[model samples]
Target: MAAEALKSDFGGKAHIALNDPKLRANFRRAMDGLMTKRAAQFADADEWNALRARGAAVRARALAQLPELLERLEARCQANGIQVHWAETTAEANAIVLGILQAAGAKRVIKGKSMVTEEMHLNAHLEAHGIAAVESDLGEYIIQLAGEAPSHIVMPCIHKNKVEIAELFADKIEGQAYTENVDELTAAARKALRGRFADADAGISGVNFAVAETGTLVLIENEGNGRLSTTLPPLHIAVTGIEKVLEKLEDVPPLLSLLPRSATGQPITTYVNMITSPRKAGEKDGPKAVHLVLLDNGRSRVYGDSELSDTLRCIRCAACMNHCPVYTRVGGHTYTFTYPGPIGKILTPQLEGLDCAGDQPHASTLCRACADVCPVQIPIPDLLVRLRTEAVHPSATAGVKGGGSAQSLSESLGWRGYTAMYGSPLIYRVVTRLMGLFGNWVPASAPMLKQWTSVRTKPKFAAKSLHQLAREKGFSHD
Candidate 1:
């Protein structure tokens, strides 16, 4: 959502990110502590693997029948008097939402924590049209007040500690004391958002799982904010990526079990909401009008590829970011995309296309840690490798001339020179002496060498060749 700083230049952004001590420490502590909790949740490797296998099977089957499932879901929702809308892109999704709000004459909206909305960049879109949408989730509200995109999908404000959040609250909300106490801080946030919730003209939320067989929308969260955002306002709007659909209500148990355990190491979240319809005739409370927006936004592209379709298996548990070595060091801001971390590596490229998300796939070390921790068993490392190939060697690109990528002409030329010199013994001898004589004099000013010396000192090549010295000492090739 935040314009990837100097877009598609991962190396440049990573270089700057790698130097942030605070970012590094916060990510390390949070990721490490949460990973420990996750590990504790599954002490039995056998049981854990079994659940993952089950989760993967359920997702594969659901995805295999996605088209049928989606249709069934639409029918079920419509039958319950919930209007369903389909959006092929972010702009289309935003337009659909705005149209609904305008039709209802809604001025103020309160939103539950929905990454799909973030994907659409809906807050800014709404603000541009003079519609005020406020985030109701505690973490989301904090980041929204700070005027920042979520760093972590599951924990939107995971990057901000209690003290930092206290500072933020004291600065933003009027008449609030600067208290670092967690309860006090949460209470302050609750008090601040409570007024907005009651005044909201409409409520918008995201679906964790959509049941096609029964036509239901499922939301899981720790706080009651999700409840307020989806039920309090007269108009309720729900949005989710199309991949969230499941064929049967029975399949939800295994996934529901896996999501919180893998995400926050809890067996079950505090609130598991199932919305079958708007408030019925006898219901005293609930939105009178309800709408569901199914967003494609390149997800169908990912789903269409059999090899990449496994990516859709993600429940947005965000386990990939939790255990990621690259993500932990650089933090989410470095990725400069909505998703960030390993999942972002594969998903961003497909959704945004290779041109806009060109540098994202290479942001990983391909360590396969993400695949190992994934509840649905998405082959993240393999997918990352696949995306990397597509990014660097796009079918239309040859020799990397002018694609607006980090691969420079000088880097390519340097590689060519290295290949030539290393292949020939005579050329190697000539180069080694020239290197020994003047390698240090090559200077940090050299175009190719500057990248290597950006953070560390230049290396000094040895004055004498080991082969020559060995020959003088009468040693053979052995």
Candidate 2:
């Protein structure tokens, strides 16, 4: 499944998603509700702006000294008795995790919601090695059961409505009957997973904020599943991108203030678990050993660019996805990557090469709605434009992976021709006059118009040029 994702067929998948009425309806309803709720949370314009600014500043400060902070984080965590591991790539990270689980003689593992693990394809890797890993988050569990990827960052199974889920449960879950009652479905899921939490050999979770000053791994969730996933088992392993580290504990408040409100429009999540170290000498419930795996996975390449480094400031609040018009219509699956929407458009191509995901940069409408709502004030639209340019005429020094892979001889020639006509006044006048004289004679079946006319009308040209009209009106002199 992950191998197939490397091939770029975004246009084909987007076409299918656009035609699926069920998918479109699901996304429309979900996105609308999320947008409404988030707006209500930020009803006060003054407060919202102030909070967003602070959040952006906090993230920027951490990223500016990311290397120093990471070293500090490792030192502090080791001092606190939490072992830290580093991986340069997903393959290495998977190997490190598999070795840890094997060393502990673990066979069954329960996991909390973590996009980093998804990026690594960690579940598939573990299963291949004869270890069973179960997603404990309700939304994550539903998708896992159905053999699907998450349709949204915050809501994994948002693409599945209650009736669909009820049918799935009835078919998949033992001793379960088909029912649309939300509470009944919830109870059934609880009954199924309740035993796994207690019996699992190990727990794995993602860190929302890894504080360097105190070496704390913070996770926030409404369900107690994250708490259980980290605490119940004797061995706990936390994984996150290196970009998730923060400079200090004080930097957490502004981000915490923005994450939930921007994600699901809540004042705060039900649970915010902070793990300073493994179980202390006197503690009874926490894990006996805790390991932190900070995975670089192309993050350093992204960090090298002064402009693209802003991408690291993302808190994964996913506010950009919630407000994206393109995402609302096509849904997450169209991107064919772990992340979907405005963030994915800029992020995927950078992590994966442009050769693999170059088409993703062209998927946006450049609406700037994502930038406006971003908690960290990332210039999403500007980044999209930069990526688009990189795909064709990339910077020689930038060294973006697979840069210029999307360039084409015909496209380059066409642009050169356009430049030539516009650069010379005599050629421009001749071209415009000729276009006005015979443009309407061109057929919709014309080769140049085929793709454009497939979904739109062929434009009709006036017999008189705008230049001629301006001259007649005494508005111009030649």
Candidate 3:
């Protein structure tokens, strides 16, 4: 899909979502449940901080030596008889996977819950090429039927209510009555998907982590659909970003511990599938042919920048989105990208390029709540500020001049003046008196002054600055 089309669709859907009380309520309930469960899970684990630290360290180490690690991973996978392909961009990645399917003469593909697939819009690509790609994950299948994008990272259809899902199923399934009951919906989805699973020529999935030492592709999921997707078909392909690689096998345990708690608050997912290679002769069930596609897209560029390199450490737990006030109010579509929320604010600009997505960096309130809650302690707020700095730099600003031109210049000057005033008490007093004079010009009830008055009414202009007040009150200047 074109970026403009995706952006327009996202904006329209977001407007509808904003007015949807049912969706809003559902999101609130789901977010609250997940957060409460996560907090409780972490409360008992005294080593949570240490685990987060280790997780961050592991990711950092992997990024520092990503090329070496990827080479090692490819070698190990090749030794185990798994085919690996390297794609420098999205088009190349899609072509590599499509070529594998065509080479196998596969007409049908069953896909698990893979955000990378969503990022690549793989289903649409397959359909455009006359291949049928069935989404096996319950939520993903529902979205595919509805022709909509996933709203949440882990829970793709979090925006849908049970009633909406029931209606969708009833419309899609022959001779089925609409019902909101959970069991009925689940049974309907299962019946619809069983045939696809049995007949699919290939299974495609996303890797949560790729271990260099063992060449293992790790998938963590609650639904077990991922396991089926990787094992049921004769051919299996795992697509993942280059950043998903880890340095050592030992790094997996700490990351595994952090993921479930941070994602859905489960101590462990119902299933964790580790696939090192294709099925061996003794194996009764597993794909006979296995392939791994390491996708770069825009990650390699991010790795070169010091400020953005840390973003490669994200485990995709999406804790930041759950805790983000802006994300909650605006929903995921406002982000206009694959990822959303505070991390998106930083990552999207870097991945998409600041020239195309510079506005994203300024979307945050810089509240730091996301930073506080992040499992890996990524300095998300700090990154956002840096991105904004880059966006408004002289050259960048000159390229995008418009209505905010005067305001931006004024704001820049205001910051410069404030910095100068902070160097001396006398200068600070002069600045405050000037501010007090300006404050007096506006009516107290004016919208511009409302923010200041809401918390405390603007103080009457002082004859002198705080330094004079301190001196008059007999307080030492020191």
How far off is residue 384 in model 2, in Å? 0.5
Candidate 1 lDDT over 262-305, as tens digits, reads 99999999999999898889889999999999999878867766
Model 3, position 335, has a per-residue lDDT of 74
lDDT of 1 at 300: 80
Ranking by lDDT: 2, 1, 3
Q: Flag clash pairs in model 1.
A: none
Worst 10 residues of 2 by lDDT: 1-10
Candidate 1: list runs displaced more than 4 Å.
1-9, 12-18, 395-441, 453-478
Model 3 scores a C-alpha lDDT of: 0.82
Predicted candidate 3 versus true structure: per-residue lDDT over 267-310, tens digit per residue: 99999899998999998989999999999877887777766688
lDDT of 1 at 419: 99
TM-scores for the candidates = 0.88, 0.96, 0.84
- Residue lDDT tens for model 2, 345-370: 88888998899999888888898999
Per-model lDDT: 0.87, 0.92, 0.82
How many pairs of residues collide in model 1? 0
How large is the C-alpha RMSD of every model relative to the true structure? 3.4, 1.9, 4.9
